[model samples]
Target: MRLATFEHLGLRRSGIVDLGGDGDDGAVLSPFPEGTDLLEVIRTGHVPATGAALPLAEVRLLPPVEPPSVRDFVTFEEHVEGVRRSVDGTAGVPDAWYDAPTFYFANPCAMVGAHDDVPVPPGCHALDFELEVAAVVGREGRDLSPERARDHIFGYTIFNDWSARDLQSREMQVGLGPCKGKDGATTLGPWLVTADELEPYRDADGLLRLALTAEVNGVEIGRDLLSNMSWTFEELVAYASRGARVRPGDVLGSGTCGNGGCLAELWGRRGDQDPPALRPGDTVTLTVEGIGTVSNTIVPGTTPVPIPSARKRPRARP
Candidate 1:
């Protein structure tokens, strides 16, 4: 089922995308027991099939869920190696990556929805977007095995991990974080497709078989089969759940796909043929087959939030 959270009558509502009415002029139906949000529905673990449908045009869509927390994992080796190569011309997915999935928490408060405007932070010379997908945790669980983790996935949503590459490049030199570089505006969705909706696409090995494509202003930048990911959602979730509670409304992202998903990787592969930096008025559309698409426009920020200066090194100890 395609589920969404939207504003209707000045109030936020959650629903299933109902296409059977008006011959394709589909509406969104608040699942049985309307008024509660998608997060509550996920926590419920079962979407009741009966509800009243509202015209799709009657509301403005919001990110499928206002996640309690977001953990984005770097599960694609090619993306890691390519990004690392672009940054330093060395360091393939380090042996540590092979040891286990690595991830970081993002600012859920900064999340936005499809067609939302992403403010281009002033001084961000190399604004970029990541083509990615995310799975929302259905309920709370800790110390889950990969086998158990698979059962807790509620649904999937498209994520455009907006980036400030130049700022990112500067920060990583200190070996700490992608902090301010990311944690800005990350786009989350047009809709959320429940895990059951994608069941038919599951391969024999239980990995999802779906295609992901990214486009900027009508130009196709990249495409890849999601099944190519080395670390499955199960592993990412399991790793994240180890000794830690993963609760309903939490999110886990499948980092960038292999090749051309971001400007830095494309630039490294193309040499001087770099794609232009994302700028005001530019639109980016990311689509995952079966799940849906999210298109966002770059807009100017009201004022530049000055970038913080890195701390200077202390005098060498004698």
Candidate 2:
């Protein structure tokens, strides 16, 4: 089912979306049981099948699920190769990456629904967006094997890992993270499609075969098949669960797909001639087959908020 969380008159509700009609705005929804929210559905591993249809256009779309914790995993080989190649011409996929999936914790508070304006975080001059697919964790488990990891996933949704390439490049030199470079805004919805809805797309090996794409102002920038990912969501979940617990409402993302998911990669590949950094009023849209498209427009800050920098100080002894 195509499920969504929406708001109307200051109330947030979870529901099933009915896209059977004629027009774009003709979308309609049927709410879940009263007082039930998305987080509750994920926790219970079940979403009721019946609710009255209400026009989808009449409500405000919220993130499909407001996760308790979010973890993004880099599993696409092409994307990893592109970023690595940007850093050095001879670099190939990281060898260690083949042995295990790598992941990081992200700020869920920074998320906004699809169509929401992505405010230029103060000081972010080179803002960019990453097109990704996220897996929502369900139930609870620890030390889960790859064969069982898929069972813990409740659903999937498009993830836009909004980025500040300039800040990311500078801070990553310290080797701890993409920290403040990221953390500002990450977009996560139009709606969430349950795992069962995607069962037909899953291959014999357990990898999903959805085709994914991203565009800026209606111009396509990138595209890739989700099946091309070197590691599957199951492996990512298993790896993430080693010595740790995977709980309900935790999100795991399939990091940026093929090339052009972000400007940093584009600039690294094409140099100074690449497209300009995101300015106010630009819209970025990402689409994944079997899921949906998410579009967010950029809005610049009124005043510049450059990141503070530090300089070396001379020692008295010297």
> Would you list the C-alpha lDDT of every candidate in the order shown?
0.82, 0.82
Clashes of each: 0, 1
Q: Estimate each model's TM-score.
A: 0.91, 0.91
lDDT of 2 by residue, 1-318 (tens): 888998876888888887876745777888987678888888986777657787877888889888888898888777776665553343667688878778889998988998888888777788888888999888799999988998998889999898877777777778787887788888998898889999999988778999988888888888788888778888888888999998988889988887777665676666552677788889999989988888899997655556567777776683
Off by over 4 Å in 1: 20-34, 46-51, 89-91, 307-318
C-alpha RMSD between model 2 and the true structure: 2.9
Off by over 4 Å in 2: 21-23, 48-51, 85-90, 302-318
List, residue by residue over 1-318, the lDDT tens digit for candidate 1.
888888777877777886564633665555445567788889987766656777776677799999999998887787887777665566556888888778889989988988788998656778889998899999799999999998999989998889888878887788886877896898888888888899898897777989999899999988887887788888888999999999998989988887777877776665543788888989999989888778999988666666677679886898
TM-score of 2: 0.91
> Candidate 1 has which clashing residue pairs, if any?
none
Cα deviation at 37, candidate 1, in Å, is: 2.0
